[model samples]
Target: MTSDATASPAGKIALVTGAARGLGVEISRQLAALGAHVIVAARDRRQAEGTAAALRAEGGSASAMKLDVTSEADRLAAREAIEAAHRRLDILINNAGILIDSPDGGTPAERQPSEARESDLRRTFEVNFFAPLRLTQTLLPLLRRSEAPRIVNVSSIRGSLTHLSDPTSPVYPIRALGYDTSKAALNAFTILIAEELRGTPFKINAVHPGWLRTGMGGDRADMSVEDGAHTAVRYATLGDDGPTGGFFFLDERLPW
Candidate 1:
């Protein structure tokens, strides 16, 4: 952990996981554009480096780290690397996730809750819920060293418990059991940790970036990736007066 005296005077330092492409890369791009030294993290080193290289080509300050969010070794190594170079971390985006089952794939019976495999449930939670939780814990020390540390958990509207239970809600009819529940768990984490850090300059939020036309979201989804990246970027770069421990989509506060 770094002391306040050694904190970088440069722009923010941000690490975004699963940033090789899609929503992750978009978030990294926007953060880099905002003058943050964005760290593009992915399970594959080549892909992560490629994404970071592309960002540099666009004149953004960026780098790449090989990080499989699910691995403890990767998480600690990332913390060490960032601490060595930057001392403090201004932003941490827990963006790595999985949607093993989707509405667009498999037979309806295959995707149904009753037919869902235990392996699928565990895998989904491993990536979506547990990975971020553990990674955040590992990096908390570095984040605390910053003047205003922001943590954004890339969540989904499907995580809304109110929507899941309400038949009239837009998300009510849709069900990807494992994926949805995992996001819900992530949302819970955001609330809990935010409360624990309430008096500090930390702002932690679970943001839904809308139904993006990405690999996980599928082509039938409504929003563009550009628009989908907005909410997370907004929260990730929040002001001192910004709300924490909240679920959000754009400016709207979502229900638990």
Candidate 2:
């Protein structure tokens, strides 16, 4: 394990999953800019390394790691690597997620809850819900070693139950059952874990990065990747007085 003096100046270490492209890439960049030694983890090692190289070229501290969150072997390897290097992790951003049933391309012309397949649901849950929960559990020990640990689950506003049920809600008319439900489960996990660690220095919360013009959000999205990344970056670097077990978009708390 590396000594404290060898760690980042802030003594902060961050690991971002699916950091090769899109919002994950932007999130990694922003975190690195804040002086955190960022780990740009992705299933593809080459892509991950490329992202890390770019960050380093821009004068930010970053490195690459191969991590397929859905694979147990990869998860164990990631834990071992972190333990061997930093010995502690200050921030964990679960930004890796999938949208298999996106409306951009649907068999029935529009993706709907009624027409969603079981396979799609299971696959979506595997990445969005289970992977984050398992990774957090696996890394909890390292996180405990930090003076102030922060876990930011990158969720979506579509997971909001209130918004989904209300007729007036913008997302009420559009339903991507698999993706939305998985994120809702992730939000629940955040709340449960935060409550379990309530009195501790750990701050766990879910943030809805606005619908950005990423591959998942599609070209019609109103926000840019940089704009979408701000919320997660803010929460990931939160102070000791920051709120936990909450759902937020920027500074506003959203309905569960």
Candidate 3:
């Protein structure tokens, strides 16, 4: 760890899961640049360290945490470490996700909604929905310690059931059953969590980070990694007056 302070000038402590590459890296960098001591956590320790080091190199306070969001051991270890080191957590960006089904919609037989493998759907939920929900639950103690705790669930437009039903929406045809439904579950989690913490200082919301050119987004995505991270970072750094239990893309409120 660096000799610098554990908390940033903003006096905020943030943990960003899947912080090794793409939007995760960009989100970490943005938060670190804003003087929030960012914990770059990923399944790969080395990659997380690299991200933390890069942030430090850019004159930001950061630390690396090896975290596989799906692992119970990792979730507990992260909570313990944060409690010991920072005592409180101000921000958490649940950004790790997977897209196992065909992005080209359910044109193919096996990839179709009716024929998609249950195993793949289950795995997607484990990573995209269950992992974040469980991790947040595990870290609730530390979050309660903060004056203002922000939880940003990095969701997708594909998760919008309204849009999914609308033939006019761009993603209406791009139905990856596993990926889409997993995010929908995440959205539900966000709403329920926020409802539970409504009068409190916690602000929890799901973010739709637009189509971006990342590993999951593929080469033809319309946005960049930086652009993809904007909404998540926005929700992560929201003020006490900000809205919660909502899905957002930039300033626009998305349909649940």
Candidate 4:
């Protein structure tokens, strides 16, 4: 791995999943602005196109792709498309996630851990944990071809066992068992993969995008989408010296 701190992303290729809107879109915009050819990937092709078009309008190199991370077919198609076009994927931001335990457009409720249904837990894990893992595994070959490959798993502070165990922690009161557990699992995957790829140039880390006012974060979130995307963007474009197998919020390392 080249430890060049001044590395540039000018000729790199990146893919941001669930980038039709919210933090995903912001992360795509930032990566494109940094001179990478970014693929705005979402389940909705039209929405992805719109986001990619907007990024291009801002003088960035970007395109759209349909990627429903949970589907095996979509995963294969994404790999094929990237292989045909860029031939390598330099950066991957696994930003697609969900919070299904919350009530649908209604008042929030305190869901007990025991009250979380098996179906809800399974669906949450499918999207939040398993999907990213499957997609990353599928793209590992392309990522391996890059000189400096990076994988940023967009996690949440709510997933932190350290925070959950502390009564003083702000996330202590927020108990969505399904979402929290899935993110925790995602973080674990980050560590496991980073360790496996330790001697290589691949930099993989789990990041907390901070609580933002997105569809999932609800209206009362403390941060903006732009601010929320900062962590993922920073780690996505990490220099060769950047840390791997870690959890970070912005530049600050978080307790695992």
Give the per-residue Cα lDDT of candidate 1 at 193. 100
Model 2 quality (TM-score): 0.94
Per-residue lDDT for 128-213 in model 2, tens only?
99999999999999999988899999999888999889989777766889887898999999999999999999889999999888
lDDT of each: 0.87, 0.88, 0.88, 0.90
The TM-score ranking, best first, is 4, 3, 2, 1
Give a tens-digit lDDT track for model 1, residues 116-229. Answer: 889999999999999999999999999999889999999988888888899897777667788889999999999999999999999999999998888877787788889999
Q: What local lDDT does model 2 show for residue 8?
A: 31
Residue 104's C-alpha lDDT in candidate 4?
28
Residue 218 of model 3: what lDDT? Answer: 78
lDDT tens digits, residues 1-256, model 4? 2234335677789999999999999999888888999999999999999999999999999999999999999999999999999899999999999888775212243568878799989999999999999999999999999999999999988889998789998887767888889999999999999999999999999999988888878787788999999888888888878889999998789997
Pairs in clash, predicted candidate 1 = none
- Candidate 4 stretches with Cα past 4 Å from truth are 1-6, 103-110
Please give the clash total of every predicted structure, in order. 0, 0, 0, 0
Q: Looking at model 2, which ten-residue stretch has the lowest summed lDDT? A: 1-10
lDDT per residue as tens, model 3, 1-256: 1112122327699999999998999999999888899999999999999999999999999999999999999999999999999999999999999888865322322367987898999999999999999999999999999988899999998899999899998888777889889999999999999999999988899999898888878777888988888778788878756888999998889999
Candidate 1 scores a C-alpha RMSD against the true structure in Å of 4.9
Q: Candidate 2 vs candidate 4: which has greater lDDT?
A: 4
TM-scores of the candidates in the order shown: 0.93, 0.94, 0.94, 0.95
